[model samples]
Target chain A: MTPKMNSVGVIGLGSMGYGVATSCIAAGLETYGSDIRPEVCARLIAEGAADASTSPAAFAGRLDAVILLVVSAAQCEEALFGEDGLAPKLRPGVPVVISATIAPADSRRLGARLAGMGLPMLDAPVSGGSIKAGKGQLTVMAAGAPETFDAVAPLLDAMAEKVYRTGTQIGDGAMVKTVHQLLAGVHIAVAAEAMALAARAGIPLELMYDVVTHSAGNSWMFADRMQHVLDGDYTPRSAVDIFVKDLGLVNATGDSLSFPLPLARKAYELFAKASEQGFGKLDDSAVIMNYVGSELPGTRDN
Target chain B: MTPKMNSVGVIGLGSMGYGVATSCIAAGLETYGSDIRPEVCARLIAEGAADASTSPAAFAGRLDAVILLVVSAAQCEEALFGEDGLAPKLRPGVPVVISATIAPADSRRLGARLAGMGLPMLDAPVSGGSIKAGKGQLTVMAAGAPETFDAVAPLLDAMAEKVYRTGTQIGDGAMVKTVHQLLAGVHIAVAAEAMALAARAGIPLELMYDVVTHSAGNSWMFADRMQHVLDGDYTPRSAVDIFVKDLGLVNATGDSLSFPLPLARKAYELFAKASEQGFGKLDDSAVIMNYVGSELPGTRDN
Candidate 1:
């Protein structure tokens, strides 16, 4: 069935955004794809995006929803309010679905700013990475007014397998997503530590993988990311830098509450170290290399 | 079919050992149980144990396999070699199935000591708690000679749902179990940390549990243990001291290899801190109190 939304623009056509735009097109929405790189726009258009442009003027008020699949809250603000942004051009009351993993406070602030401009906002942060995004199976932790949610239902349905209505409060979506990142980042870091312990203990990495995946020690992250470790492929399915940013947000949120997040802090430090050591751009499983001698293929030296 | 073994003894009839002994009885093996606590032995005898005695002499040579289900390698050694220990009384060629979580080196030493007495050894370390032990559904990570495995197959089947033949090499079972403990311990620590972050972030504790258990952040431990957190129950299904001990073994094993297990070390420290603060005997989820204000029901302050 055709999505009810007439047009939805996807900004930031990077790995995750690209899949989201493609999924929108697959669902028969009038999907407009934009990216900083003209080649990325051209690539999305070639793969069935209705149109590709850097300028928002072509769609303007015709766009029913804009999915801001950018990197952070700052990027979301710049995309919406910058000189060439869509804020002035988009029709009043059009919902902006913010899918970036930003701090909860920033989400609320951004939502309020958009609402001030007579635009409703859906504070929606996504999980399940790029592959899931391509399959239209990403999970959206969403919070906004019922009307805002209703307006974006078509777009969300096209891009997500599950859309959790966290609350009506603008930042609630970000709050849940932030909590998720805390666990995700921590699990990955600990997974790396567990693997490192296994490696250093002389346990066969394959056997370690098998046993852990089947045993109580298993986590979704450990089973998924450790495969990247086993393959020695550090290609960035999810980059280490993402955790560096996400866990930073986790710690900051905890700090605001005077909450002691000892484990999150340690995980953040590991990700920060990985980024500093130049493995930031690699798959996050490359954190395993920090513990084991750099046996992985994507080490900076290699 | 009746188990090939005539009589089997379970030493250290604590919560876990009592279950093992009962399961053996359920499987129609003649089971003897021993415990330091007379009441525990009395309880086991009431359940189904053929005999309950503090002395190993009650079934020593007659026990075709003795499942050592104590706390540590030291306890395993003491049970076997201490004055009135089973070592001197066990029949030659009877296999002593060592099911305690211990250092791989210690397992090897135990195996060697048993072999010196013409007794075979199965370095089998079990997972799944007392509940599973009672149902004959524990997972046994086992290593020993083929003959030893063949001879103990019926008993293994009787007591375990899955018995992984990790290797024939002595201590391989302990090696795998040690690695399992590394992940299990870290996952629990990080889970507590994540729950604390959520609790302090003003996300409702139940919501945090629901979202996390559904998200990629979920681990087997988190799903199982976070319920205790949600109920504010500190009843010890597994006490905090267990991780203190297990993670200690993990760190020690890593230390022996000069392997840097940074995450495991941090988790070990957290468990150690919880122990130091006198929550050692509380449920392991009490580690959450270390992060949040001590509002949980079983906090030591209360």
Candidate 2:
């Protein structure tokens, strides 16, 4: 099995990153975690992680794959091969696996530059949310050369339930993630519209949600996310701002392909308005509050 | 129990209508069947249905209810109180249970006109579809006076697992049905969009559909319906024209309230386009053909 390169480096210990890093350690990798946040680095080290230096200077030959789990395409670029980037100091043969949800163009362009430097790249964006990630039940859509897959096969099997090899091209993984987020965003928006209509109709909100959920009228987004509106729980599982980024990715990608995504464009407007109305940090379902114009039905602080 | 009036008439003998009429007969009511097509009437007669024409005229005093399970609002109107309508011919106390999918305002107006004839009217639109109807497992949304619910309680119990007494106003049940259709129509559209994007990106669509149904992207619509697409079998469990009608109900209600249902509106437009493309008779999942521009991925037939 080519000696199983077992050491892995994970950058950005935010929600998704922390889950991935923990799952890596849980999967018995010598996992190293780095973040701009010192407390995150300390916490990971405290949790059986190999002590990691945030500076890329300490990583010349230890990692088989440096997984980027940051936020934006810009953040990914900054973390990878920036002035203090991982690309310059990391060992040449190890692959850089981009796990962040990002634009396909960014993945393809960066993959090309990395290929020129003799480092293989795997564009892998994950699903199943953070909780599943910590349990190593993530769905990873990965696209790269088959050689890149062969190099990191052991780590992938440990960290994910399924590793979908979309194509040899680097952008395909990001493309699938874009498609997933598009439905996710639209489903939530439609659920919101349904709920808002019920709310205006003066039907008991919870009863409406319960009946709709059990009936043919239900959607995955409605069943999972509408409870936030019913319980008035605006806690940020996946925040309102996440869709802002994801839908922007959709708009960008749709423009590139000349596809008219009216639903995606409309959903983006709603979420953008919700984010602008000071709910950028609340759970994505809180986008429903954009319509009701008040606190949700039953939420109260204990 | 207003003497448990023995005779009842059920108009229309499509799948849903036939099931309701048979359920009434199984409950020991002398149920009458009527349809524009004489063949449907002949089939119902073989199944122990009295012909509606003779039964309504000869047993007007004992007819307990005229259950209209016609497909649309227009058909329900035509049979119930239209020019040669049953409302004027039936003796006063019998209820007219409208199980058709229709607009609330239309149901409200019909209720008023039926009430003027001294007849109780229950706007009871059903869910759980035709199979559930045959099994008496549908959920009924019934709204009218207490006497109307009392009069129809046995029949409701026989036909449904749950009967929601939404309000003592006939329009409430229709309102709930409209809202239910709103969520259903939009969810199917989102599912099609998500699946289409995955198929184009070359993720074996069955795999993507399976994973997403298990993941955050799931809804009742996806779980119940996407299999038809994955199996490449569009056998019209619920037809595309059904959504066109349901979403029209959504827009009609939304317009009355001046609510901007952008997501649902766009979803309706897509289904409308699909219907215009000669797929109106196929399963609603065939809406994917609008995006995929062909029959379902593995299907031999359109």
A81, model 1: CA deviation in Å? 1.4
- Residues A35-118 of candidate 2 have per-residue lDDT tens digits of 898888888888899866576457646887788889988988888768888887777778889999998888898898888888
* TM-score between model 2 and native: 0.93
* Cα lDDT, model 1, residue A224: 96
Model 1 over residues A1-302: C-alpha lDDT tens digits? 22357789998898899999999999999899878888888898899888888776677667889998999888898889988888889887788999999999999899888989999899999998889999999988888998788888888889998878888988888989988898899889888887777666666778778878887889999999988877778889899999999999988888877778777888899999988888899899887767766566323232
Overall lDDT per candidate, in order of appearance: 0.85, 0.82
Residue pairs with colliding backbones in model 1 are: none
Cα deviation of A274, candidate 2, in Å? 1.5
Tens-place lDDT per residue, model 2, B70-141, is 888788777866776777788767888888989999898888888888888899999988888877788887
Q: What is the DockQ of each candidate?
A: 0.68, 0.63
